[model samples]
Target: MKIDVEHVTKIYKDTKALDDVSFTLSEPKIYGLLGRNGAGKTTFMEILSGHILASDGEVLIDGENPFDNQRLTESICLIKEGDNFKKDLKIKNVLRIYAYFYPTWDQELADELIREYNLNPNAKVKALSKGMASALGIIVGLASKAPITIFDEPYIGLDAAARKTFYDILLEEYQAEQRTIIFSTHLIDEVSLMFEEVLILQDGKLVMQQQADALRDNAYAVSGATKDVETFIEDKEVIQSKQLAGMMTAYVYGNMEQAKSAGLTAEGIPIQELMIYLTENKGA
Candidate 1:
């Protein structure tokens, strides 16, 4: 399931949610769609999921347009943030409906997750707690077994333990059943390791897309005497810099070997911190 987004754009009155965004994602890998709030992450997901049409350009799934294409839509499952079901439906009923719609849905997996999460299948969706609701959504998303599974901040209200469970289960499922997973979330550090590739969006534009390991290797925190640190990054892209007392730490984006030769102590920067620096300061 290869997704090719070409020159896609979305306009909402005065706001340009997506500005000519483009990317190509090959199948059977986890992709992290990362960005700050209102950076077009959600918009991109919506377009790909066939929930919204792009104002310009196109989005294709294996060379076919996905918007309103039932065949394509059936193969792509998007777990958005917040409630997506009718309030009156019971938890079990919701899963049953989804199972009917998605031909590839695994009932056995769904049953296992239902038991693991301890969800009351008889309980109405409106009566469930936030965490329980999120768990249910995750179960549906994973059990659907769509070729392209997208989770947009799926653990919004989950606790640490519950989130860990979700991550573990997701990975296990992925290994057992190869699929394309696009995870968009602000919890970058928590899920960074699971991503094979990362796509970064900034202010409605696609800024960077690279292998997760390569991106992490390129991002580093270099610190030394203020003068030496500044000199070390003279011509490089410095994402962030701060002075604590007389010492300064600069987060520079480039090859680590370049900084090592300059005698600067380079430390790995957390993906979350890197995202903040890139999106907050316009890749400063």
Candidate 2:
């Protein structure tokens, strides 16, 4: 399935959540949707799932608009941190209700996830801790097997071990299903490897979208003597710079070898650092 956002914009009273954002996903791949607080990441996903109408422009799934269309809406599953389940309902009942809603829901997968997450079917939703609630969302998202499965910061309150478990399960599920997966999270460095393509939004706009490896290759970090670093980045575009006691590290966007040739040590910048540099003050 393909998703195309053409001149998409979302406004809420005095604020514009999305400012004519535009992009396209031409194939089924893992996409990392990234942005800072109130940067329109959630709003963008809402538009894709047809949960809310865009203020202007359109979002198309395979050449057709998804607004109020049950066929397309059902095919896209958007899971978030706080999935509103009936507080008094037991875990089993919750899964049963979800099974009825999603045509492609897998009973076996649901059962497996319950055991994997160590969730009791008899326990009411209100009794579970925050992490357990996140686990339930993960189960529904993976077991639904929708063509476009979206996870928006779905692991809140999850410990490191539990978060790692979720990531492993997600990769395994995607491998077996071969569906379009959209994962939005602030933990970029840990989950960056999970993405084939990365889309970054800043201040309600699509700033950058590129293949993960290709994007990394286009940026580098230079460090050494302050004078040497400054000389190395004299003509290049410096995304970010920090100085302390005559030592400087400047994250620059350009050829990696160019900095190395100028007698400065070059290191690979992680996705999180790249994001910070790109959206620090004056955004990319």
Candidate 3:
């Protein structure tokens, strides 16, 4: 499924949720939607999911608008943060309801996941804990088998072990059925490995959209004697740097295939650290 967002902008009474944001998702792969708090991530997700409209520009899912369109919306499953299920509905009934709406829903997978996540089918939706609720939402999302599945911080209440289980299950599901997955979360270091592409938003604008591998390939940290480190990074775009006494460390982005500076220690920058630097030093 190809989802094209063109010059999208959203404005509130005095706040601009998004400012001329644009991107194209032409393939079925995992994309990490990253940014700091209130970086227009949720706003953009709402627009793409058809829960809200862009004040300007358009979002096209398979060359068609998804706003209130059952055909397009059915192909997309958005598992929002926190619990939003009916208190009266049992866990089993909730899955049944989801099955009714999602045409590609898999009952077998749902049942299996419910057991795997230790969620009781007879328990009421409101009776479950926050972590259980998140687990149920995750189960629904993975079981939906929608062409486009979005999980907007769906693991807020989950612990490290449970989160790991979710990630493993999600990767397995995606491998079985290659579908577009847009995942947004602040736990970048933990899940960055699952992303094929990373999109960073800042203050209502899309700051960067790059492949995960490309970002790592281009980003590196060099440390050595101040003179050597500076000389080695002189021709590169340094995102962040620091020095103490005679030692200097520079975070750079560029081709370093032939960079053979003696006494310099070069290391690949982690995605999470790079993201923090990018957001902290905007427009640098």
Model 2 C-alpha lDDT per residue in residues 38-137, reported as the tens digit of each score? 8899999999998999999999999988889999988998988795588999999999988988899999989998999999999999999999999999
- Model 3 scores a TM of 0.95
Error of 3 at 97 (Å): 1.1
lDDT of 3 by residue, 35-82 (tens): 888889989988898888899999999898899999988999899897
Q: Over the stretch 96-183, how does candidate 1's per-residue lDDT look in tens digits?
A: 9999989999999999999988999999999988888899999999999999999999987899999999999999999998899999
Rate residue 91 of model 3 by lDDT.
93
Model 2 regions lying over 4 Å from their true place: 225-231, 242-247
Superior by lDDT: candidate 2 or candidate 3: 2
- Each prediction's total of clashing residue pairs, residues at least 3 apart in sequence or on different chains, is 0, 0, 0
Query: Against the hidden reference, what TM-scores do the models get?
Result: 0.95, 0.93, 0.95
